[model samples]
Target: MGQRVAYYRRRRGYSQAVLSGLVGRSEEWLSQIERGARDIDRLSTILEVAKALRIVPQRLLPGPFHTTPRQTQQSGTIGTAPDVVPDIETAMLRYDGIAGLVGITDPGPVNLGHLERQVELSFVCSQTEQWSRMAPLVPGMIADSYHASRQAVTDAEKRRAKTLEALVYRVTSGMLDRLGEPRLPWVAAERSMAAAEMTEDPLLIAGGAWRLAVVLRHSGRLTESTDVPTAAADALRRDDRNATPEHLSVYGSLMLKGAVGAASVNDHSAVRDYLSEVERTAERLGSDRNDFWFAFGPTNVSIHRVWLALELGDPSQAIDLADAVPLDQLPPELAERRVSHLITVAWAYYLRRRYREALDALTEARMAAPEQLIFTGRVHTMLSGMLRRERRSIKHDLRELSEFVGVAG
Candidate 1:
């Protein structure tokens, strides 16, 4: 990675100082990075360097991301998806966008209400980390929701159906992202945004933007991800004078997404600004709430602080922040968030070389949401990293975790 950075810097005719200044780093830091004496710990920092060098982030990425790792390799591609992913992908691609124009045939009269209920149920299942129950229903939901959206008999029903379709697409995008199947999640996010637009609902549209931002960040479109959600957040602010709880919920959630994106690119100012705004928004909302399944509130804001701290390469700060979070107060529907926080804690522990604590946190996360573990890329990557540097005392437990997350030990 250092060698690639040095090569690109020279190719661009950038002196070390110029490149370092561009990324807000000192000349010595840049020199050390180029000499392989210092590591760029955060992907965001790498992205900043890549942008300064005017190359795709992948060009600066190490080989592990490009190919499967052999034994003892610390980094690499997130492995394959489960069998269910292909079926979900097929359902997503099979829709021709002419479904509304063509109408439904086999399913008889489209039950928009029933379809809405089922979509809501699927979201609940997903939020609660019930992957096995949610996974099988998704393909059908996508197909049927499209049909219902196109076949709506009235403006009210049309809005309702379109909203359902948008939510379904959001769910699908999230599932694909969690499963580490990248490309289709973008498609699903795009479809979600389109479906949301048809409804002309600000909240739903904002929700779509949030989903797209998440997918964009995961795909390494870090800057665009932040811009997307920030735009949505601005739109919401402009359109509402007296924001309701739902409005604030979605707004705060967008701010949170923007904060994460900003952190990913090492934009410290942007991250601080976004977090400050979100903290204020969370305070206005008074407590934790799951409006539109965002799970945005005070607790969620603190959770983001921990995550953003970690993203900024401050493992100690992240661990300190994690200690103060009120995890026991998390709603049962927010099992997904709880699991994610646990993983973040595990990451913090791992970074601090507290191997036993990391393993214990990961174990707690898996125990909290076992089915969700297989779909998460972090679990696989971290397990592989731990396996590469395993201590004899925890070797057996670590291997067990690697097996659980399907990483070869």
Candidate 2:
């Protein structure tokens, strides 16, 4: 381990003092680390060293260690979707490996058409919350797309391959975010943005920007989160005439995301402006369409209305708006969104002191997307809040639901 640390430090031209200062460790501590005299067992420290060296943490380990499938099944709290934990770990490892991004020996003339279909399938898997099904497919897809891009003889073919790679990374970022793994999602989002730039496609770049904003929002950088989507929306608005349905869908989704960030910070005016813009865009689009897998349009816009209202402390209005929407009409591919909406509805009901209705909504959310509801912080918060209402009597069903979701009864 010490030798590996020394090797990476030298490879990056980082002296002990420089690397130590960057990671906020003493030079002596770093020296001890590099000399095998210090035993570094903390995952956080290992990750920090890897970040300083501009490499994956696994790179510093003696040999690559992977969590077995059985181990993932046993480690329930690590991710809400336990079935996808192994796949998420595998995909992260592949992202860490240089070989996955740039294949050796040209991959011998891959077919871009076949690769495109695989990428589409992966996107569907991600959207539908089919984590167990999607987990085994992503790492190979990323490698194949990279290989295809490298071996392409024409600019068009190369661009197509890179675009597919960008989409794959976008899906990867979404899955990692769902698992609540912070740093890996940022890595995937950045990779998606880089590949999108390589393609020089505005729509794809907007998609990347959307992913980055989501990562920022998840990381609680609310101001930067709002800024990223706001800038992307501005760029998209400038190219409206030539914009396809996909472009408008991405643009509208960005507007909604910016509103989410704005609402988080109590910027009511910004939230209203962004939501209004999305409403206009949705009106232009005419209906809900899952363009670029975003599921953006009128129905989605309404859903975000509920989300924003709840964030802004108007739970009654949120419930009213949520009731006005035809949530059942949402496409089956949008299971995660439906789950989120149901949870939001439950939260609103809880706020109104309607415990039975809240329990029913929460139960429906679990039925719609068990993994998502289990993993969602909002659901846990709502349930815990309900449980803590000492004056109100909690029902047996609510108690069961709370226990099922691993909340205190």
Candidate 3:
């Protein structure tokens, strides 16, 4: 730990005095820490040091620490190897594993009840940004759900099982996107769409479509991305009269995804249309709800407004809209949204050339969800861009941020 701190500090060109000043510690104390004479056993202190360094807490710790009891229990069986940072090929292998599992499994009786619980667990993992913990479990869950769907005795049972299967793939797509794997998310999206279609559930189909659009948008297939959610939103609009919260949530989420896709391609008109649609849906929903794990509601709508503003080159407007977001209304369990909010704040600050403020925002984002921020490409890119443009104006913390995110300064 001391070695790591010293290495990162030196890598960022920070003197001991400068690093200690940022962390609110004396140079001698920092020296002791760096010299392996002081222990950093407290999680809070470690987190504080990491935050000051603009790095994730995990980066300061020894490898493969257990974050949950379940993870600890599974550790022995899962092997003691440290968590490897996932790359595009790692993401691809996950998809391949899923496909291989599906192909090799015979259509046999499956415990749908157990599989349903696993699905719920997987969703929790996704929501909480437990990427390393979740990656190993998804392929098996998908295979189990697929087998259950295949062997179901009735249509309702089949639909339920297949819906779970589709959701697993949807979660995989989301996880891959969060992990900075550009193209592999598309593979998961395609699998999700196929599984959703097999379920014959309109809501499931919409969910899958939005996931596809999200991956496409991230991969720069802006036109196809916009087309996907637009068509899904059109089909879903036909049932607007009797829409449930889940229905509205999925619909609104799709619209938001479409808005992003449009903004990506500078389709201002389409962007406005999509944002307007989501705003209206937000009004109907009235407040935040994580229906279908979409986290759709007025608060989320406001956040997207900020996101869209940032996308459209209006950082001031984005910051203003962000100020209107009811942070208290955002559920604590929605770590992904919170991390995203902070990331957007960081982007807005960066756009304004407020480098210190931007670094602070990103630091807060890493503190909020270190696992998510560490794996996010956008966060690293933002840090890199800021360092590239403002090298002379850079502070020690920003230099540390650049090193933390692997950006050459």
lDDT against the true structure, each candidate: 0.81, 0.76, 0.73
Residues 100-155 of candidate 1: C-alpha lDDT, one tens digit per residue = 45553557667776777888887887786665566678888888886776678899
lDDT per residue as tens, model 2, 276-297? 7889899999988998889998
Task: Point to the candidate with the largest TM-score.
Answer: 1
For model 2, the run of ten residues with the poorest summed lDDT: 63-72
Which pairs, if any, clash in model 1?
64-76, 100-150
What are the runs in model 2 whose C-alpha is more than 4 Å off?
1-97, 100-111, 387-394
lDDT of 1: 0.81
For model 2, what is the alpha-carbon lDDT of residue 213?
A: 96
Model 2 sits at a Cα RMSD from the real structure of: 11.5
lDDT assessment of candidate 2: 0.76
Q: lDDT of model 1 at residue 56?
A: 80
The number of residue pairs in model 2 that clash at the backbone is: 0
1-409 per-residue lDDT for model 3 (tens digits): 7889998888888999998899788999899888755444233456567777887655675442322221223222221111332443343454344656645647467777887787787787777676666777765675576566667778888788778878888887887676555455788789889989987889899999989988775554567888999899899999999999889999999889888888776678988888888889989988788877888998888888888887777788988887788877777678788888888888788767677777888887765556665566556657766665665656677787666444566
lDDT (Cα) of model 3: 0.73
